[model samples]
Target chain A: MELEFVDIRVERDYFLIQGAGIFAPGIHLVSGRVGSGKTTLAMIAAGLKTPDSGRVKRHGIGSVMLSMQFPEQHLTGSTLESEIASWHLQPCPVLALAGLPGREKDDPFSLSRGELKRLHLACILSRRFDLLILDEPFSALDCREKMATADRIGSIRAGITLIFTHENQHLPRVDYLWEIRESALEFLGSVPDALVGWKNKPSVLADLHKRGVYPKNLSTADILEAACRTHD
Target chain B: MQDARLRLLTVIILSVASFMSVAGALAAFIWWIIFTPGIRTIAKSPFALFFLGFTASVSAVIWLTGGDGISYLVRMAVILLLAFYAYTDRAPGDFLDLSVWLFGKKIGFDIGLAAEMSLQGMEVLSDEARRTRVAFRLKAIKFGFRSIAPSAGLMIYSQFARAEEQADLLAVRGYRGGGMVCPQFTRVKGDVIASTSAILPLIFAIMPVGDIFILLQ
Candidate 1:
């Protein structure tokens, strides 16, 4: 599915986004400083929020799901099992998919932060949407679930994926990159093609990467391989 | 079709509510008459009297519906009122908050866990805010018509700074949500004594006044 916006403007008290468009199919890795309207742009694209001017046109079949930054806010059910079930028209196997088998009977509120994030992501991934919107999704997961999610996203790179992140998180087999600059989006080519820009990335991300002691690539596999090779 | 246990719990909960409603109405009506003998608040308080009267009437209806009649209704209303009087001095807010805390601790998540989980998302917001602020400080540009962004940026930055620190603090403890699977509640001596001595009278008082079992006594 492809989404085209001719010229869109979203105005917030502290920030504004003007003239944003996406003409890609795979993951569009979005990065920006705070208040760049990256999230607003994503939400507007997904039809969750409306733009002040310009048109947002969607040429796709299937659904668009916006997985939020928090898991508990998304929990409408008082119980864990019902919350997952309420996500779909039918029963959802998310409890098992999220590797939370027995916790189905347990309360959602009672799960750890990382566990809740995983459970929420499992719900998002369980259904196929034309566009999958995940905002800062890599927060609270262990290395394993993070890898698991990245792999799942990579395999199903079938739909349009808009991932908003501040971390130099390896894009899950992405096609394009958009940096939110001064409340507007700046195109940074494709993932590996955009490696040059990664070198010049701010110290915040680069420092973490240095501390992580991994390769300079923006994908988990490359980092993993580099680490394993170092060990060997 | 409620399970027997659920029905029993429901009966207890509703009966308490019913008793409280009547007592509240009585207090309001009396307060209006005594304090504001000619005040509008007193006059307006009579509505609660109507409401409580309606509730007591409903208890009567419930009594009759269960195949019990006037003697049952009067007795139940009397019992409920008596229970209300006996518990009159108890602060409602403290009692309810205590129950909420106790229930949260007992069956659902504990206060610490709920507070922790609720605060986790705030971390995500704060992180995003902090990054946005750092970038803002890096660029330090004054963009017009988008004052909102910077404001949100600053707010998020401050909130996250405080929140992430709190999250770090929480991690210092074993806060893995289910880390402290609560100790299973067993009826101890205090519980048994409380149930037998204190709660039995309250229970009978809450029972709609005219059940043959209660009336026979």
Candidate 2:
């Protein structure tokens, strides 16, 4: 499956987001500074928003799912059981995966923001979609939860996944790298090659790059491997 | 309009005048064009389309029942226009200043605080509703008869949560009843002129139609 943005342009009050790119069936990491239209691009890609100009054409994509930045916005069910059931998943397995097993009677809103985000991510990652757009997936997550979420995202080997984040640490293994610079989305080619052109890269990646150690992917494990490599 | 007291008084006079008769509506419309920002502001508002659809439906019903649908439409439209003008022209602490100025600090301060919070709540409610709509769309759920209950429940629950947070914040800030605020207002020459001229429409509205024609003649 492939998703294409044909000269898409969205005009907000302050800035204009214009870009054209193709997203193939793999994990794509799109990064930008805060208030840099990351959420806008995600919404446009997920078919939840229409751009002022151009068109988004989805090829061979039947179902689409967007995990918004705020997990509270996705709360439709009062209780945990009903919330899990809202996603058409069994409560026991999903709750266990979210590390909240047997708390089905508890209210979803009563959960801490981190716990709610974990539950929301668990619900989303459990199912497969042709086009999955996650906006700021690692937000409100602790360091451990962030690492676990990255691993889970990296294991999804099917369809197209677009992760929009400005998160400097704990990222999934990505196939392509893109960023929004000066209100326009710029495609920076595939992973390892794209790392050199990334402007807002994480400090660790930049330090490694300065030392001539370019990681093969953005995952923490890949970075660790590159960090431990010796020049023979 | 910079003076909250004058603006509020103008809004009240224009609203009541517009509701009294079609001539009053016409006068209010004229006042709106001259004093308020413009029609484009109201047109661009999110509620503009909803208001248009509602007015059209009500007008159609009135016409079918042999009532003066045109007059009803004109008057209501003008009144709504005045209401929108008042809403858009208001600054954040306008009501607090006006209330405290009129009713003194004790009772007036409490009312103003309530009004401010309610207005803020409305804004938050609108934002939450938009996000909820997007969330429902993401889940492949059609927002219709079946989804209204859940949607409303979510919005109401969020509002309560937000209200509780605000209360906690206020308590932490050591907020007690009736705070002191030296109400300040800027009454420009235009404000005085507009306030003086706003009385004419009310007089025209309250007088007989024949008298207005004779006076005009």
Candidate 3:
């Protein structure tokens, strides 16, 4: 499955976000600064917002889902059971996965932000969509939860997944790297090669680059492996 | 209107006049065209759909009851249009400035602060509602009568959460009550002209149609 943006342009009062790229079936990591149109690009890709010009062409993609930045925005159910059920999934398994197994009777809003984010992510990840766009999936998560979420994301084998985040740490193993710079989305090529051209890269990656060591992927484990290679 | 006081006064007069009579409604429409931004801006508001739905439903009811449905629809539409204009043209502290200028530092300050906060809350509510709609679309859940309860529940919960956060912020800022704020307003020639013309609608509403015709003659 592939999703293509054919010269998509979104005009705002101050700046315009214009880009063209094709997202193939794999984990694509999109990094950008805050208020740099990351959410806008995600929304456009999800078909929620129409671009001012150009078109988004989805090939062999039947279902699409966008997990917004704020988990509270996804709360449509009063109880945890109803919340999981809203996504058309079984409450027991989802609650178990979210680490709130017996809290089905509790209100979803009553959960802390991190807990809510976990529940939201669990619901979105429970279903396998052809196109899955996660916008800042790690924002309200703790370090452990972020790592767990990243691992869960990395385990998905099929379909296209686009992750829009400013998160420097706890990233899943990505196939491609893209970034929005000066109000434009630039494709920096695949994996380790892409890391060299990444301007807003994480400190670890920068350090590794300085030492002439490149990681196989963006995952924390890969970075650690690259760090150990420096000693070798 | 640049001046909040004059704008508030114009809104009140135009609303009353429009509700009072058909001639008054016509006058208000003319004033709206001349003074307020434009009909296009008001039509773009999220509340515009609600207003149209409400007016249509009420007008249908009136027609069924053998009342003057058309006239009622016209008058109500004009009144809602005036409200939309006022809401769109409003600055952040416009109502607060007007209230403080009208009342004293203690009572006026409290009232103005309340007004300002309420307006800000409305903006936040609008944004939340839009996001909720988008979320509903993403989940492929059709928004109908069954969904109203959940939507309302989310709105109420969010409002309470925001109110608590605002209270905490105010406490952190050492807010007691009745703070000092000098309300300033910039009046242009157009503001004065618009404010003056707004009175014509009230006069038309108060005077008989025959009397207005004679005066025109």
Task: Give the share of true interchain contacts found in each model.
Answer: 0.00, 0.48, 0.52
* Clash totals, every prediction: 15, 0, 0
Any runs in candidate 1 off by more than 4 Å, and if so which?
A89-92, A169-171, A198-217, A224-232, B1-217
Residues B1-217, candidate 2, lDDT per residue (tens digit)? 8999999999899889999988888888888898878786586466656786798789889999999889989988888888778777888999999889998898889889888999789878877878877777777677786566766876888789989999899899988878898899988889999988888788878997789889999
Give the total clashing residue pairs for model 1. Answer: 15
User: What is the lDDT, from 0 to 100, of the residue B73 in candidate 1?
Assistant: 43
What lDDT would candidate 3 get against the real structure?
Answer: 0.91
lDDT of 3 by residue, A81-179 (tens): 887888999999999999998999898778999999999999999999999999999999999999999999998888999999999989999999999
Candidate 3: where is the Cα deviation over 4 Å?
A: A230-232
List per-prediction Cα lDDT, in the order shown: 0.56, 0.89, 0.91
Query: By DockQ, who's the top model here?
Result: 3
Candidate ordering by lDDT (highest first): 3, 2, 1
lDDT for each residue of candidate 2 in A77-139, tens digit (9 for 90 to 100): 768887788788999999999999899999777899999999999999999999999999999
| 1 or 2, greater by TM-score | 2
Compose the digit string of candidate 1's lDDT tens values, residues A1-232: 6888778887887667885576578877777665567667767766767898888888864566776666654654445676666575233367778778766667665688898898888877877777877787776877777778777776665788888877555445566777776676777887655644553354544654566544444567765565555442
* Shift in Å, residue A228, candidate 1: 8.3
2 against 3, candidate with superior DockQ = 3
TM-score of chain A of each: 0.82, 0.99, 0.97
